[model samples]
Target chain A: MDERVLLTGAEGRVGRAVLGGIGDAYEWRLFDRDPPAEEHDHEFVVADVTDDEAVRDAMADVDVVVHLAGDPRPEAPWNSVLTNNIDGTQTVYEAAVETGVETVVFASSNHAVGHYETERKPDLYRTDDDYRLDGTELPRPSNLYGVSKAAGETLGRYYHDEHDLSVACVRIGNLTKGHPPIDYERGQAMWLSYRDCAHLFERCIEADYGYEIVYGISDNDRKYYSLERAKDVLGYDPQDNSAEYTMAGEPKSDV
Target chain B: MDERVLLTGAEGRVGRAVLGGIGDAYEWRLFDRDPPAEEHDHEFVVADVTDDEAVRDAMADVDVVVHLAGDPRPEAPWNSVLTNNIDGTQTVYEAAVETGVETVVFASSNHAVGHYETERKPDLYRTDDDYRLDGTELPRPSNLYGVSKAAGETLGRYYHDEHDLSVACVRIGNLTKGHPPIDYERGQAMWLSYRDCAHLFERCIEADYGYEIVYGISDNDRKYYSLERAKDVLGYDPQDNSAEYTMAGEPKSDV
Candidate 1:
């Protein structure tokens, strides 16, 4: 096998974008709870990530897993997050350990630290507050969905801590089409361009960190995140920025 | 009321040390699965932390909780660690949120970061590598028991981030008395003197930090952890060190 990689949630928007970018880089084994419309890469495995047997089977002959299979709704209930996100992540990690997978790129979200926006609002986005959300800051999720994402990040931490699995948690910011929201201030400040997202995660797949959390955003002028840590640790270099589209963007009045 | 605190696991080793130190500082409502042998200075409630109703009933009038109720054995079975430690901790945090408690001083353990020792051993203690185990370092627990402690810390994080409950996680080192074994270098380096343990926890109740992870070791020449974070964040001032007693005077040699 030429660096076989398992891509869970291969049909989702983020997953598809990642696959579209790096699908040819490795021998891909696509996985999703529901089947995709078109064939993905080389192999496809349709199954729920929470199913232990299914995950274990998917890990066979695979060296790495881009685990993106979970309920992504911001308003998901605790029961949904518990089963789909938390338990599913635990199962994936245990199986990765059991199968001797060397690395995993967990799909952690900005929502993992979403409440920071309320505290870091308007000022960092539009007004002048030189503060930024670093990966080192403690997670403050705004909803149950964010809680699930935080749990996934912790699972990566546990797997790396216990099994020494190289894991990277990308606290992805808002991702927009073609480019970031051209005139939206907060979105532009937080937008992770598609090219940047794929390439940053590509760094995650290749970097050697015991366990790390890095933001996924382009080099945006309005970004309220410190990209220095990510650049120093993961060697991430984002080419695009939301600033390319607009100078005076709309205000985010969510308090 | 001057200040009221709920001390969980009032019978455990760490809990007893904390109780002995601050028994007079705050009006305590002590909780444990097994009641104490003698009368206490304040109210004592015999209740399991896993029981939400019991925890809630005992949480009333509590300003802060020194949560030391989970299974502490480093070699405990997975089932026990899961039910008693992980689930029980979730229950405690939920109950705290339900009762609107202000802060939680969680007793996290060194084993949460013990695997780092095995990987860099001999050098860490045997040789003078002096690779300090800073609180910022990602945990690499050596055992399932360590995983449980990590889970407890995450529970504290979730409660703090989501519900605005104040939390402080203390990654306690090896705690023993009379002296740390000189022959057992790991023990000596990681030893937490009794008074230091008590006083360090006393600071947990006294100082303020929204969410923090701090090393629970006194200022010792042989220490492998940095106490700067604890001192800066929690105002912790430890008063004892194992070096005060010669290692030859200690009974145990096993680390």
Candidate 2:
């Protein structure tokens, strides 16, 4: 598709992942609070997501926005999360609607439903356990950061209903680079390989929907989050599995 | 009970309703942006809900908080709702935890699930429909204000799980003083009398719950929201019914 996509927090890990995979796929308008260390293919706008005027300016002709700009700390204080994550997300959504941006792919986190893991613990993360949390479950944020992400998801829902904007919130899991966290049960269950991450977001941009929420994780045998919604709705075909990366963090070549 | 209840937005409708019914029951620390027109019952603190320092100061020694301070307008802009509703709520929750406040009774609205009314409209409002929306259903906010209320509910959930702060989010319906709305099918189905409003908050203070959401409408026959959770969990015994009032909204003398 020849869409003019605005990637907020372009310097962030997720933004970079998308860029590395599909930088030439769309006309990119990269936005971040700080300028990139090395620039390249797309037009970049260095501005805080909370700055409505700057955000609105960048959103002028955007078709889709992959909004990943926020204070991504699980232990973030109320002030930081309120300002950077919650307020900033609201600004992005409002500006997107104002500038007539078609779709917004919000980067929601697993922390939005983190408390579920707290209760279930070892059983939930184990390879044998089959219990799964689809997007249908109510939000039970573990912290202020999670609360802000949930708020962002809610905002997307609101904007979609109120303004007819298409929104897809991706509740991203343990997104470590190259390999999943070594020998961590919880990490293994919720791991999202870099390629899968890029492909999931690509589906977000290409998919047609009103308001949707799908878990962003690779196919894993020890998973608690169901990837059925993502596959069925977004046609997200994730190739890499956390099981491929062994307990010692080495990639297993053969069956 | 002999609790020191700090009622924020004390001069507002919900606050006034609570005070009108149970003002003398507690040691009241009434805080609001505007001072009451003529006050005589409790110690009042005049400050905006957005004023964190003032809110924190007023929260000291408070047992429970009935946080109703927010831009209650359904058509509220992003800026107003963002500041007054969302951020203000976060401050209240954070301060409640900081000051060792026992519970927070958040005044969430029926608008949090208003979209359910959109398609099922006219028919859903009928007595024969039998379709009810219990508190268990996910929020489907119809407006920005509703979105903020949903966010507040989510905040309460987060605070409850992470900090162990007891919370009850009352998804209040049409709260009309004295009687129910006449001739309006939707209004009659979700009417909340002033007496019930006061009693609900009273239960929020008296009863115990980890985290919950209860519809705050009275025991109306033509109700769309289920009062099962409220009655069972919070000991909410509402005495009034919208059916008691005539279509003209006048109370029948004989009945």
Candidate 3:
């Protein structure tokens, strides 16, 4: 728990969730394109992920990198995603290997396999459906952004195979604070509570794996992404479930 | 086969194979970064695939595009692959969508899933070992070049899903002219004959598929990469088999 973890994109939603839940768990070096509003405990570095020198400098003495920095937009332009997501991820991997970083927990998105939802839409999102997409399936991206995420995952695979870098790509689901998404069946099925998100990423850092691709969702009842890999490989024991929340995003009574 | 086909990277090896075999079949618009040394039977245009305007211009009135343009080297650097392979592919997809091109036969390499051979080594290259990697398997790239190819495949997936354009990725094996590779079991296992390579690309242009990833190897007996998808989907009837050749790369005699 005392490993000096370099958390890129430290100001983003996923970054905030990881820090908010497990801020005290690790010796942190936070990196982001933007400066922190107010500094507190961890060392903060304001630099773009695509900046090779800055990323290498940030990786100095860092054991693990929770690489979450990138263009996160689903509809992001090709130029933006290519530069920020694909290129930036490459920079991180190159830096990590050069500076002797042990592991990289890449924040891959559900969009990497987003087209899997195309054929099996409303039914796949329902609790009655038995179909699921584990992490082993080929990427069928639905957008340029998704393509970028898939590219990032492939980059991780390459780095691991070539340089023996321990890499784990968390194909993260719909992470929402407090409750699941309101009235959205797909969102509900793929919902990841903030606490579970933090826990999943925590396991990713702590786990000893050569390379892995795992779904980063809570134990949702109406789910298509299998959490078996995450549970078995990363020892990720998620405590939250989307089924605990009503369709209206309200907490259901335990009665 | 009289469709106005735009052939990118017309100067490369695969382009030569296709044109050499099926030169007179299609009304061709040849495109390459380098100008043809001699006069071609078809119209040729010199332009980079990364140039969006140039690609679109080349796509004008094109019914099919045999996109073979990129850094072909397996050891190509990150910047080269990023720009030539990934960015160039996006540009092709964009141009194809914009200019109403019907089909794209992408020259994807076996390197896209090269790491699959890592654990299974020389055994998987033998005829007795039935371990096969069908098209449905996820990418396990071993190098940066492989990563870029996988990224291109993902980009094709995105374009097919979003724009309804037909895309077929031919994960081509080691394409050698006349005979199998000399004393390389891995190469012999996945060896693609020049004639078979041409026919495969022809099938890619002719047959109908929404989006597909097919092994472009010949009917090699010592193969781990399956050609069933290609045969079933694209009606790819390959003629040559590497098993007909000796380990020293000589064609076996029929007693």
Candidate 4:
């Protein structure tokens, strides 16, 4: 798609992943508190998402937004999450509405429903176990950071309902470059490879919806997050499966 | 209950209603931006809910908090609702969590599910119709104000799940002093009287719940909001009925 897209938190991992995968696909306006590490062809705006004027300015002529800016700490204090994640998200949404932007692809996390993992452990993580969490479950955040993410998702819902903005909240699983977290079964079960992350977000940018939430994970055989909605709605076809890679993150070439 | 409770928005209509109905039932610390219009026996603190230090200080040793501070206008813009209602509620919740408080009684509004009314309209407002919203359905906010209240409820859910704090969100209906809105069938269907409003909140403070949502309208014959959850969970047995009052709000002594 050649629509003008605004990618917030361009310096972060998720933002960089989107840029690395499809940076040239769209006319880009990258916004972040810090500049990117390497030079890029897209226009960059060095401003916090909480800065209303700068955000509104950067939002001009943007059609879609991939919002990933926030405190990414699971143990972050209430104050930090409240201001940086919750309020910053609100600013992004309000500015997006003001600028007549069409869609916002929010970076929600697995932590929004992390309690399910704690509640249904060992058996739930087993390879044969089939209990799955679709995107429709009520948010059960495991920490204050998770709470902030839940709040952001709810904010997207509100903005969509009240302003008629298309919002796609991606409850992303464990994302790592090249492979899953080494020797961690839980991580492998929810592992989302970098290419899969990029593809999922690309689907989010291209998808047409009112307000929707979908899991952002690869086609892993042991995954507990159901990607049916993502496939049905956004036509997301993830490429890599964590099962093909060993716990040490090496590809099973013999298979 | 004789526990020391902190009542934010002590100067508002809901606060005044609670104070009028149950003034001597509990020890209270009243907080508001403006001092009460008249004198009172309870200790009062003048501060905005957004002021973090002041809110935290007011929360000391408080057993329960009745948070009512917000911009109440249904047509309120994003900035006012986001700051005054959403952020303010977050501050109250964070302070409650920090101060080791047991519970928070949030004052949500009927607007949280206002779309049902818009959709059902005259048929639903009829005295014979029995369609009801039982607080189990997903929030369908009709305005930005409603969106703010929904955000507050979600925040409560997160705080409850993460911090082990008990929270009760009361989706209050049309609250009138003596009777329902004049000559308005919709208002009559969702009216919450002063005494009933106070008793509902009293139940909110004393009841045991992990995270719950209950309708706050009195037991009206034409009601569309179900009170079963309130009765079963919080022991809310409202005494007043809007059907017992005339369009002019006078008591129907000879029904």
i-RMS values of the candidates, in order?
Answer: 3.3, 1.1, 1.0, 2.4
Q: Give residue B165's error in model 3 in angstroms.
A: 1.0
**Best of the two (1, 2) by TM-score:** 2
TM-score of candidate 1 relative to the true fold: 0.82
lDDT of 2: 0.90
Candidate 3 lDDT, tens digit per residue, A1-255?
A: 689999999999999999999999999999999999767599999999999999999999999999999988999999999999999999999999999999999999999999888888989999899999888898988788889999999999989988999999999999999999988888889999999999999999998999899999999999999999999889999999999988777889999
What's the lDDT for residue A95 in model 3? Answer: 99
For candidate 1, write residues B123-213 as lDDT tens digits: 6774356678777765567776777787677667767877889999999987776566567777767778777888888888889789888
Preferred candidate (lDDT higher): 2 or 4: 2
Which candidate ranks first by DockQ, i.e. highest? 3
**Model 3 regions lying over 4 Å from their true place:** B247-250
- Ordered from best to worst DockQ, the candidate numbers read 3, 2, 4, 1
lDDT of 2 by residue, B1-255 (tens): 789999988888888899998998999999888877885578999999888889999998999999999988888876788789998998899889988998999999998888878778899888899999998877889898898999999999989998999999999999999899988988899999999999999998899899999999999988999999999999999988998888777887773
Candidate 2 TM-score to native: 0.97
**Each candidate's DockQ score against the native complex?**
0.26, 0.75, 0.86, 0.43
> How high is the lDDT of residue B61 in model 4?
89
Interface RMSD of candidate 2? 1.1
Order the candidates by TM-score, highest first — what do you get? 3, 2, 4, 1
Error of 4 at A147 (Å): 2.6
